[model samples]
Target: MLALNWHRPLMLLAVAMAILTLAAIGGMTIDDRTLTGLPIWTKAVKFALSVVIYSVTWAWLIAQFTRWHRIAWWAGTVAAAGLGLELTVIVIQIVRGTTSHFNFTTPLNSALWETMGLSIIVVWLATLVASLVLLRNPTSDPARNAAIRYGAGLSLVGAALGLLMVLPTQSQRDTGSAVRGAHTVGLPDGGPGLPILGWSTSGGDLRIPHFIGMHAAQLLPFVVIALELSARRIAATRPVAVRTALVKTAAAVYTAVLIVLTWQALRGQSLMHPDRLTLSAAGLVAAAATGAVIIIVRRRPPVDPATIQPTRTAPGAIR
Candidate 1:
């Protein structure tokens, strides 16, 4: 197990999120109010949980930097503060019994929404700065290095996807409603959705790809860790070169999947009801990833038996 020099500010932010998560969970039990067809506290709980994961992952990631540590630390701190403010606005809106996002019904609501938008932009920019720093300083372990670099790049892409949700839909424009935008592409915001996630089941939901993309940073690192652990029993995965190749392959597939999900959402297709084209595209990506993994495993160098030492007989009994 490697020792991690965790960033204090980011870890504190994560702790705050954990506390908020518990508060939101408790609110859900007592509060019966609904927003956009779901429990009012649902958004709070989800955002809190997401922030906890994001903060913890970034805390660990920023801690790994030896060069440009100050720059990385500042970036992480800015990101933590921005995310904290964003979540704070969500909780405030929940208390106010109104939505926090894309809301322009009143001056106060519009200002709150604008604050969130600005905070998100700040967070994204801060993440970009840290990512550039990571790129400049690579770790010695090839697999871990690939995970950090690719994960940061993909996470930025995912965070950018949120911008799409701020654009007013055609209906909103035609109706001239105070509400400026929505999460659903083809339909209104309140509609049939998944259980806890509340992702649209009737229309396209941009949040799906956005959620997947943002977590890539954590997920990719987890992939490298899993491969490293498997190295104990799987000889083919033990080689640094092999593990690096596999990580690259996994990152490629992950990117392809994100693209597919984005394309599907843009087409106003529900995740629960994927069209043939979406299915085909997903299948193609899966096939490519499978083939790549097979080739990588097969190309592994054969272990030399000459290097294996023979077991010596105990004392003089066996001899």
Candidate 2:
């Protein structure tokens, strides 16, 4: 029998991220074609994204745990509670006529919803603690250990940002207070323009939410990729091959994605659009930063490539 090793967890993370990346593609497939129940594309994206996200999450939790009996039990309990609570609130809000589910009309609407969105926050927090526990290595958790630190830190940052979208902040109170019924808040008849996110077009607005959500797509994914790259072996056996791969991957793949994202940002009929500058430039910067980090991490590695080899065969061996 093959022994278990580092590649196991690494492969798990890579697969989960790959799936989430595909889900993002599915999300982009969503168009304004105007079908109900989530533009089909959005639903696909959401479903896939949700699964991939939770997979990384639970996997991490499982990995971090040296002992899983009770932890697993509690984790399952928290997840159940979250799902149940979230559903109940949405049902209540639906029955009460708060929202039509078009632009976040459910009780789970907005950032603050994380706090009350069916205990999603609590469940996510539980999952987080578990992942951290799984990855903890007291003897090897130094700055030199960028992969672990990057993985744990970036995941936390991404989750925090996500929850930030869920738990709405008080600063976005352009309409009546949140205490006011949903009827009071709606998209403007003019619909400011195609927003990156949020429901500015409706009676209410979700600019912050959209902005926050969109950024996470770039931020967390890249950060995780960075960790994975940092964790890669850089031995004489793979140095030239890996380094070449790093440069090509960063310079090409991201270069293309950034171009598309930038073009989308700047292709407006007129540069006078309010968000044109921010979208084109800021989006570029964020993409560049993420790309740069990935390249740097790929190039930078304190771990010996020889050390990263699998001592035991994993179920999902590369070859």
Candidate 3:
């Protein structure tokens, strides 16, 4: 793990990110409506939060994949570039009136930011899955290989998408009056062109589908983390009793957090249509029911205890 130990900077970066994120949260202007997109603030916090996601995830990915530092570096770079490009899409749309400013209530611009953000999350998930697949050797062991591959692969994919970019505004502009975008700017006089650089966030709401997807990364990653933990505990167990207990414990926590995230999605809706408690309450109930179903379906199926070989064994033995 010498190759990995050489990444104190990455850990430091994560810590710094946490600090900045907290600071941003603390500094927000406290009108509940403001956060939910009711009013436009001088600096938009939600979009800023997306940047924090990229930064924090990028840092963690690098630290985890230190053994493959070079590859991790490349992926992180790409992911960051992707985030930047997404940001540019947001800014351009906001500044030039091609789309709505990251607000969910309206479907003005293409949901490119939310789309790429989720894509990055997917890349991270892919790394985790790929790592698990790679680490299945007797000598190196599946567990070990998985950890290394995920850490490195996530960081690398993150980097590539970072540098490569697509312009969303240019997209809507080409279509002209067909798009009424989040930016609130639209076709000329009656049809063919947008009011160049037009920007407005008046009455923005969170009821839209794109924002709901944005919150899933927050929920899904944690779910994956919980599942992986449950899996590891199962593999480490030599007996059914121990595996059963750990898996249950992990599932309980995972289910709870998943519900919490679903509720969060509703919070966006609340912002969009003020005083619509019926809609919001309905959402809460739905999110809870869905989370429950997911947890129930994810329970560990009965398996023979003998099937799982120990994670570590003699040199030639399966691990």
> Positional deviation of 249 in candidate 2, in angstroms?
13
Count of backbone clashes, every candidate in sequence: 0, 27, 31
Considering TM-score, which of the candidate structures 1 and 2 is the better prediction for this target?
A: 1
- Superposed Cα RMSD, model 3: 12.6
Encode model 3's per-residue lDDT on 1-319: one tens digit a residue: 3432433433343344455445445544443332212332223345556556545644554555435556655555554554455545544443443333333334444465466456556545544443343343222233333333333333333333332222233445566534323322221111221122112222222222233333432443453355456665545343333333433433344434334433433343222233455466556656765675455445555687999887666797864
Q: What TM-score against the true fold does each predicted structure earn?
A: 0.92, 0.42, 0.37
Full candidate order by TM-score, most accurate first: 1, 2, 3
What's the lDDT for all of these models? 0.92, 0.41, 0.41
Worst window of 10 by summed lDDT in candidate 3: 188-197
Candidate 1 backbone clash number: 0
- Positional deviation of residue 11's Cα in model 3 after best superposition, in angstroms: 8.8
Compared with the true structure, what per-residue lDDT tens digits does model 1 show for residues 111-199? 99999999999999999999999987898898899998999899999989988999999989999999998899898998999987999
Residue runs of model 1 more than 4 Å from their true location after superposition: 1-5, 301-319
Which candidate ranks first by TM-score, i.e. highest? 1
Residue lDDT tens for model 2, 148-227: 33444444443453332333233335544443222112222224433322223323333332233333323434533553
Indicate the TM-score of model 2.
0.42
